[model samples]
Target: MDSGGTDIIWNQFILGAALTRAARRVLERDGEEGEEIRFSYADTHAGGGGLPVPALLPVARKALASSAWAAAVGAGDVHPGSWVLAGRLIAALGGLAFEADVNDLDPAAITAAKASREGGWVRFWSHDWFLFLRNRLAMEPRPHFVFIDPPPDDPRGPGYAMDAAILLDTLGLPYMVTYAVDTPGAQPQEAIDQIGRSGLELRGAGLERGVLLGGGAETVVLDILSDLRNLAEVLGGELSVRLPRAPADDYCI
Candidate 1:
């Protein structure tokens, strides 16, 4: 219910890990040789130490059992606590082969992330997140999975998120992006419609974390017609989606 940039909430962490795990599974299941996953997460607003280990522990456990699991990278604010937490998780959950790379544009945040952090699989970069991603994604065997959580303070405006959605479409990669849910207008739906029209697919479109209703939590899940479905289900289900029948010509609305 409380939406802010400071405190890390359970819904965001839990649901995000779940979605990441599921996407990892789906990717590995369908990937080619050595292409299972090299997961990278770029959050333009990586807040201070907030992501709890308890929430991500389960996800780590599930992923550790698989040989396809690989490294992870984080960009944006990437608080030091998160740097440590994420690094430990990847090493523990991903074993010795996996690595953790982190970055941020804020010099102070970078300083904070390295101030007390000890040696680990983690490394740091101080630069624009998109530039880091551009280089990272171009590496051998492109990122098998990417999660982009754009910052609220970005000077580029709301179109940044739209551009990211389109980037995922253009890159033709399996991705999960977090946007401002339940906005004051029709633009979110409009963007989603346009992205769907871009010949890519919508793996899932839901709240940053599901919302609570009188009876229970209400999550978003869409069917082929983009109609809401399963009002009572807990973790929210993903709809089956196919590529656009035509180019993005019908997306001007």
Candidate 2:
């Protein structure tokens, strides 16, 4: 999708494209330095299947070389659609199907996950995200990059646990976490201003409807590229992702 189009701001695929570009940039930098860097992916909130969004794995697969295949772990409602997509994408990328452990809390989602032939490569577990990761992370290789996309929630909304930043900060790993902050006026800017502190800094962000991420709704996406390396020169270059505001959709509220 071309950045020239105003519609791209609301298009979910832009996120995937941006991520793919970032992945390629990583490889290019590694190549330039005469060193190869490979990282795995761990995703929380894997979604209830049927992802129309562009596949991040495909782009990662397309770009990587030299120990290029990395493992992945995702936890979601299993939603059958979740495991199916993960398994296929891994296979398409020449990654071992066994490398992915996608779990869900619902028995039905688990059953759906297993029922799919893709289960052969996926470890679909009937476990909550917290419990699942506790055991999963201990087994062996831990994914280097974590992606968290929680459902839309107002910070003051009922049953709010914590923002993605706090959760990612607590994990103390490189992460890309996104949230939907439902507010009006300039409050979203205030939220972004408060995102970074001591050790963590914002690497990139997406905007929508003069807020963050997809228009018509208040969605904010903040990426903390890594704590493993200093991003000063890496991100300070001219290539910056700027998601301009789009016309609010009729469905936006």
Q: What is the TM-score of each candidate against the true structure?
A: 0.50, 0.42
Expressed as tens digits, the lDDT of each residue in 35-87 for candidate 2 is 43443444444444443322333332233212112222222322223334434
lDDT of 2: 0.35
**Candidate 2 local lDDT, residue 226:** 27
**Alpha carbon lDDT of each predicted model:** 0.40, 0.35
What's the count of clashing pairs in each model shown? 0, 1
Clashing pairs in 2: 212-219
How many clashes would you count in candidate 2? 1
Q: What TM-score does prediction 2 earn?
A: 0.42
Which regions of candidate 1 are displaced past 4 Å?
1-7, 18-44, 47-96, 115-120, 182-186, 197-253
Query: Tens digit of lDDT per residue, candidate 1, span 23-68?
Result: 4454456546554344443333334433323333333334332312
Clashing pairs in 1: none
- Report the poorest 10 consecutive residues by lDDT, candidate 1: 211-220
- Alpha-carbon RMSD of each model: 10.0, 12.9
